[model samples]
Target: MVADAIYSCLPDPKEISPVETAPDPEDYQFLAVGFWVDKGTADQKAREYMTKIRNKKIGVFGTLGAYPDSDHANTVRERVRELLKENDIMDLFLCQGKVDPELVKMMAETMKDDPHHSMTPERRARLKEAEKHPDEDDLKNAQKVFEQIMVSLNN
Candidate 1:
């Protein structure tokens, strides 16, 4: 949904490709990549694509299970910034996204005996809170941010 919102805001002569099948970075003047954070970092495919890009105007947008303004989110943002430090990054936007309930249940069951397991009660509650996200407001914000990115790209 976040990617969809960003896609809607893109100008003409744009091409959309999955991170897993990334195009050559030099082929485009500007590149906007959308991804979801997994295990505290940008998705593996996104990381791979970022490594291949240099000297390009880049915009990154993504979703994560943590609250958008949380320390965890900030860390993820910084990680992405580090990956793109050699490039001209236009902007980065992140927001809460729904967690996979089945994955959460599996983790809970598998770590039931580990008192210090990562999935604590508070973490579960935060995941629950994530379920309502990537909502209308998130989509709107993504569109707005991407529009601004386009404006910057043009200038």
Candidate 2:
């Protein structure tokens, strides 16, 4: 969805696609980076790439099961911005994405008899809260952010 939004705003989006692996800085004037939030910041792959970048224009975006303006999201954004301090961080956007209840359950399962995954009341409640995510509003907000990034890039 983020990609589609960026492409929609670009004059020739078909000819442009974001790089998955770290890209050569000389190849593009602008870059749109998207990632899934892991822990308190970007996933490992994204962190690696962001750290490698220097003196380039970058837009960072991510999706997680938290509100766009939530404390968790804010911390993640701060961490990401720090990584891009040496570069020109054009913008950033965060939005909730569907966090499957099953996936959460499985993750908890992996914790396997651990105190946090023991089907405890607290854990169950947390799971329930997490289950309510990635709704329509999140997608719409993310798309809007992507469009804004495109506009920022153009300027």
Candidate 3:
């Protein structure tokens, strides 16, 4: 499994399974976590671990990514924002020792008001549908509208 391989590669590797829940941020300096491209067993397993971590009131969680520019990466980052807001937990998301600048900008832009975001008609329709739901899943559903526009104009 990807989680097993990552743990094997880590310096202080621990055999963490989804069944084992994590403690709160108050209990630890950081809640280290991982994800995989294959969302079958890997994704389900990771979510179990994250759910346990979230239940502990631990807001600080880290995610290591293979592709930083992938939509899944964007989804994870956006999901973290929704988690923080929902849990009433204030903490930083660190990829390593340093924070991700793109994520920071995304969070900031999300908090601010903007009118001229480049939303295509189809995307707008999806956003409208997401607005109807207004849940964590919906947040994930509609992030492309924000994520695409939030990227550098140079691209």
Candidates in descending TM-score order: 1, 2, 3
> lDDT tens string, model 1, 47-152?
8888898999888999998899999899999999998898988899999989899988887889888885568879888888899999999999988988998877
* 4-66 per-residue lDDT for model 2 (tens digits): 555565555334444564456557777777778877788887777777778887767777766
**Against the hidden reference, what TM-scores do the models get?**
0.91, 0.72, 0.30
lDDT by candidate, in order shown: 0.87, 0.70, 0.39
> Candidate 3: where are CA atoms >4 Å away?
1-29, 40-42, 55-66, 80-155
Error of 3 at 80 (Å): 5.0
RMSD of candidate 3 to the truth, in angstroms, is 16.3
**Which digits, one per residue and each the tens of the lDDT, describe model 3 over residues 1-155?**
32333344333423354434544435543333544323211345555555545333322333332233446556666665554443434332322112245743574467445444334454345344433333343233233322332232225
- Which candidate leads the pack in TM-score? 1
Clash pairs (backbone) in predicted model 2: 97-134, 98-134
Global local distance difference test of model 2: 0.70
TM-score of 3: 0.30
Q: Which candidate has the top score in lDDT?
A: 1
Worst 10 residues of 2 by lDDT: 13-22
